[model samples]
Target: MKNEYTDHAWDERDPSPWLALYLDQSTPLPDEVKAAWLRDCSSSSRQFFLPLVRPMARVSMILIQLLKIFLPKRWSHSMLLHRLLALSMNRFVSPEANWLIMRHFHLGSQVLAFVAANAPVAVTATPLTPMVIDDVKDELFLRHDLNLFNFVIRLNKALRTENKELLPVPEPDFSMLRQPDLRLEDMPRGKLNLLDLQSAIEIYTPVYQLLLTDNDFWRASNSLQLDETVAIYCAKILASPEHLVLLNNKHPLVPMTTLYAAYRLVLHGLSSEMLHSLLMRMARGEIPVPARELAKMHKAAEAVAAEESLAP
Candidate 1:
């Protein structure tokens, strides 16, 4: 479905080539061509997931604490599987962690059967765009907070293990709270403009569904799509630092990804807003960032930017 050849990091100002390689292409992906694709996806999954385990697991712990505010231990434990799953997928944690999650969910016994039945066998076939996102989006939306929290946790895992080369030092700036030209909530639907939150979900929601249904092999298949989304998200948030501070539990995915993305953007002076609107749409829950963290991030970005500008 997406191109596998292009290399676009999160800070790259122009993510078109990166997006084209993964999102716009329709070239056939038979097994041979798909092999490389799968490898890249594996690499991406590893990159994104490794850094997030501890953070998300901790977040899960805090959530359990918060859940205690309104619910009892039994109910919280009952939904624990969903929580772990949400974090595992959203945070992009390692496959092994997903395995551990399955064990935690008590899905260990069924995992093999699920993988065997769902994973594609070795045979020649045309690999169209994966449908993982479509199959699971509604389920994810229903458990919106868990999903959003999971994304943040997964990001932590990725950051923990990312290569030094992939980490970019961001420019310092006090911009996370800066007002945008237009609020997404205020956008009009009938006008001919870029897609708003609803439209973005309509267009991108299916990707995660596809991811859910994909057998490990197929999971391996759509690796590029995962990376593209991450890179695109990272670049967009850095250019619009204010988006990060504005996140809260109410707008979970948007703010969490934006927050993680801003961190990513800081690693490099490169940045873009191409995906900001799309991210805003994905915000199905709230995300309240601490004011102190917000201030620190701005200072970090501004400092990094100034350093880069002066670099020989």
Candidate 2:
């Protein structure tokens, strides 16, 4: 991979520049229009209102959790009570925190898909160890937070540039960022009973379905330019032996692997139905290796072997 493509994967200084660029270019709107759209979507004002309601939301969440303990396992998993509690507590939390709770599942799913697509050799060679799953979960959470922070910063900057009166957004009080402990704790743990690949797909499908219903994600998936950029990046990472090793070894910091792969498929013009079918097949170990992709991996491995042979 070229420096530009590979550097962004590890560089934390400027979070998700590639994704940000994709976002900026994909949604073509004039400055004023963008600012207006952001203003309408802004939840900054909710911060001021949150203090008044925070205590109540916290109490409500606690009661819900207590009720869950007394409920049957099936009843507890219904998500009805959870959804209600989340709705009530939503305004009391940081947008990033809420997103982490609500959308991180989807984000993690996308990351898994990327890994499965771009690092097939590594994925097939390695067992899906707990450490690997944890790494994926952590990356998903980090990317979710980074992307949220970047979006807010960019929105504010654009608003300021347009001379729009900034929304009076308060600094997030991390203490108030609470969700159900059970849910939060479960994010890092993959299902252990199933076969490794089956478990990954099972973990991902619910969230993937959730994302399919999300208007924002749907719109982004439709962005041809963004998809192409992401696809190109995925291809680069797929070709990088170091990246393959990191992914196979479950490196702690392999960022945005899944998101890039999901976008690549989206950009490659797979319909949702087709994409889902592909994921199912991939998970079941039924996906045939594309000759070109396989050839690229073989060639890269040969180059590595040759380089090692020459080394003292």
Candidate 3:
């Protein structure tokens, strides 16, 4: 969760990058920003509007084209519209848009360090760090994973507490990872472009499904774990010797949580590199978990440590 977002828009750099972290994900967002994304998801809007987004966005798309015809090149972008576009893009646009929107956050051990290490201070509007990367390091996708991430954390806790046998994790095909379908240049940047506005309204951000052939038009078929090997990377990010101990599930009791975990993995098609690595380490006895009596105390300590580092 992020600190509460106040309504103060930045005058120099656009704040959409910062806003998207909150608005699109389960993380906390500015009250008003959340309201904008609530578009039709909000309860109040349901009674009067029979889904205003698809139709309204379509109409908005037409109006945007007309505005493009008349509006001068010098003054086409509106800050308000840009803000609204960022707010709406996550729900209304393509997964490319969500992928691109996620481009805002530059991942590193620390934001400034990442910027300094990769970004040059000169010959650039802003210094590009780590060789001027557009995408943040993959570990961040772990934290920005928000509630879905919490699900992972909780599942780990449950599995370990119950002393269940480790489930077999599915092998993910990372070769499938690729760039987004939409063009980055066509997107609305710091300055507004009609295409950007239209994209915000017209495109759809898919959740689980990628190929149109994979699912129906209305239902999305993909999740973050399945989307881009996000979970696998989160596992890699946490694949330290200490983390192996922290998440170890081999306790004294033998129970059904292991079976339940397997059920979840198969049910949702979880790509389980994380679980696999843990299982290997557990089999090796490479990292010792706390004693059964002290395990509860270790769990608390592990939770706190994760709060500060792994999952925070």
User: What RMSD does each model have against the real structure?
Assistant: 21.6, 22.7, 19.1
Using TM-score as the yardstick, the better of models 1 and 2 is: 2
Candidate achieving higher lDDT, 1 or 2: 2
- Per-residue CA lDDT of candidate 3, range 1-312, in tens? 222344536555566554454345332222332433332222232333324444654454445445545654444222333344344443344332333334322211122221122221211112122221122232222233342334334444654677652222222112212222333334323322222222232332221111122222111122222312322333333332233332222221222221122122222221222233333343345543223224566678999988889662
Instruction: Tell me how far the alpha carbon of residue 122 in candidate 3 is from the true structure, in angstroms, after superposition.
Output: 43
Task: Please give the distance, in angstroms, between residue 287's alpha carbon in candidate 2 and its true position after superposition.
Answer: 30
Off by over 4 Å in 1: 1-72, 76-138, 162-237, 242-312
Name the TM-score of candidate 2.
0.24
User: Which stretch of 10 consecutive residues in model 1 shows the poorest summed lDDT?
Assistant: 122-131
List of clashing residue pairs for candidate 2: 111-258
lDDT of each: 0.31, 0.33, 0.31
Off-target runs (Cα >4 Å) in candidate 3 are 1-52, 56-100, 104-191, 194-202, 205-211, 214-312
lDDT of 1 by residue, 176-245 (tens): 2111322222222232222222222222222322223223212222221232334433433333344433
Ranking by TM-score: 2, 3, 1
lDDT of 2 by residue, 130-158 (tens): 22222333333223334433433444465
